[model samples]
Target: MIISWWKETKSIKEVFVVFCRVVALLLILIFALVGLVELFVYLGIAQDGFIIQRD
Candidate 1:
């Protein structure tokens, strides 16, 4: 009974680790995309002149 419990606990831990890794990867991807978009905007690659007149 103890051995079975230990195995079950280990399996749960492994699954939790995998889930954390997947979440980390997704966050990294999201940040990278945001950075790229910001870079483009900074370099004027995204701005097509739509004048916002002074209010």
Candidate 2:
């Protein structure tokens, strides 16, 4: 859960800065994870490889 302390913060500029920082970090982390997964698949390291298994 996100901290609600930002709601009590009194400055718009400060809140916007914090919000931007948080969003940027989230996007960077998500991209890094997706990049890693794609790298693994490209290297054929994932179990079952590119062939989808049927139920």
Q: After superposing candidate 2, which stretches have Cα over 4 Å from the reference? A: 1-9, 47-55
Every model: Cα RMSD to truth = 9.1, 5.0
Question: Which residue runs does candidate 1 get wrong by more than 4 Å?
Answer: 1-10, 48-55
Model 2 scores worst on lDDT over the 10 consecutive residues at 1-10
What is the per-residue lDDT of model 1 for residues 19-52, given as tens digits with 9 covering 90 to 100? 6776899999989877777677678986533232
Model 1 residue pairs with clashes: none
lDDT of all predictions:
0.65, 0.69
What is the per-residue lDDT of model 2 for residues 1-55, given as tens digits with 9 covering 90 to 100? Answer: 1423645655667677778888999999989877776777778897533344435
Q: What is the lDDT of residue 39 in candidate 1?
A: 75
